[model samples]
Target: MKLAWLRSLESAHQDCVWACTWVPATDRSGGLLLTGSLDETVKLWNPEDLSVVRTNTGHCLGVVSVAAHPSGRIAASASMDSFIRVFDVESNNTIATLEAPPSEVWQMQFDPRGTTLAVAGGSSASVKLWDTAEWKLVSTLSIPRPEGAKPSDKGSSKKFVLSVAWSPSGRQLACGSMDGSISVFDVQRAKFLHHLEGHTMPVRSLAYSPLDPRVLVSGSDDECIHMYDAEGKTLFSSMSGHSSWVLSVDVSPDGAAIASGSSDRTVRLWDPKMRAAVQTMTNHTDQVWGVKFEAVGGGARGSLLASVSDDKSISLYNYS
Candidate 1:
């Protein structure tokens, strides 16, 4: 494994950077990096030098999630205000605004085919799907209440969804919740299939391995990263080393390793099989909130990892 510091941007935002995703390359542009933050802005960055390309502002509260469309020309962001904003990537024009009352929004993703946008509905214990073309509410995949549960019990909020991911094949959806439960859904049927169990704290971030639809990874406040066999319904491995809450985790595009940012103020590179942190980056002075590997193609080899922290900084690294 090889790593090199690329660039660091001080004051990337006034607060925590909550989410990051790689925008696929397009004819009119090279690839871009999209990030959402507690500053209430979704920013587009030129990946080459990590320069600010544009800042899309509209969300009334902290922007918690940002996802790029598979086509690269569109993106969506959701805020704590329970609203999802779909926008044009190049022009920064709002395409549509979606909401589900009594439910807060956390993480979101655009389907691999770009046909739908999935938003994790916090408190509502469901995932909301929006039609990409018509920009209309498409479906609500709700987690069924546990057996013998009371309607007024606070346990309902335990299903507060916090993160969502789409498999590379676009056939499935997996969402992590505050209660540490992960729900897998059948996208074609818009149905909640089953739950994956492991963590006991809030699961803040999750991702599916690009090479295997059955493999899923998650980061949680429990300071552990979990590897699950989604199809097998079994926990494959658990990685623990971060001194604080693990805020986010992302698999390299090649699926060779995993990268994670944590409240421990460090970014870690892990070997999935070893289930141990192979490297630690301690350049950030505060809690690290987001980490992602740049997508494949775009004239780039190896991989690029971007990390944002409570230190109000963004740091880029070259992974080889």
Candidate 2:
């Protein structure tokens, strides 16, 4: 693996940077980077120089998730307020607002076809699907309460959905919950499939390999990252080394490596087959919350990685 330090932005966020994503390249703009933070703002950056393009405000609580539509024209952000804001990516204008009661919002993703948006519902113990065309909620795919559990039991909070992912084909959805369980759903039928179990701590982040719909990666409060065969229902491997909570995990666009950020103030690069952390970047002064690989684009050959930390900074790295 090849790596290089690019640049670091101090005070990129007032609090923690909780999420990051690469917006696909468009004719009018080079690929952009989108990030959300506990500061209650979503920011857009020009990836080449790590310059701020826009700062979107309105989220009542921490902004937890930012997802770009496949068209590169729109994006959505979900916050602790349990609201989803759909907006024009280029203009930063609000297109729609989706709200669900009591259930908090964590992670979100747009389907490959951009026909729908899936959001992980926190305490609500469900994933909310919205129609892209009308910007209206279409369904709530809930995780069933555990067997023999009392209705008044706070186990529902444990089932809080934290991260959501869409398979490459957009036919399936997988969401990681606070209880350390991952639920798979058939998107077309809006039916719950099966749960993938292994992690005993909260699964904070998740990603599906771009090349394989069956491959899923997850990071957890257990300080380990897990690789799973979603369709096969198998736990392929677990990589442990982070000294604190593994705040986020993302697969490289090339599908060859996985990157993770941790509360241990380190960013790690892992080789799946070896099931080990190949590199640990210790440039952040506080807990690192988000890590993501840049999508390919203009003047961008090797992959670019962005990390946000509790120190209120964002760092960019070159991964070739």
C-alpha RMSD by candidate, in order: 1.9, 2.0
Off by over 4 Å in 2: 145-155, 297-300
lDDT for model 2, on a 0 to 1 scale? 0.87
- Say which candidate scores most in lDDT: 2
The TM-score of candidate 1 is: 0.94
Tens digit per residue, CA lDDT, model 1, 221-293: 9999999999888998999999889999999877879999999999999999778989999999998888989
Clashes of each: 0, 0
Candidate 2 similarity to native, TM-score: 0.94
Location of the lowest summed lDDT over 10 successive residues in candidate 2: 145-154
My TM-score estimates for the predictions, one after another, are 0.94, 0.94
Candidate 2 backbone collisions, by pair: none
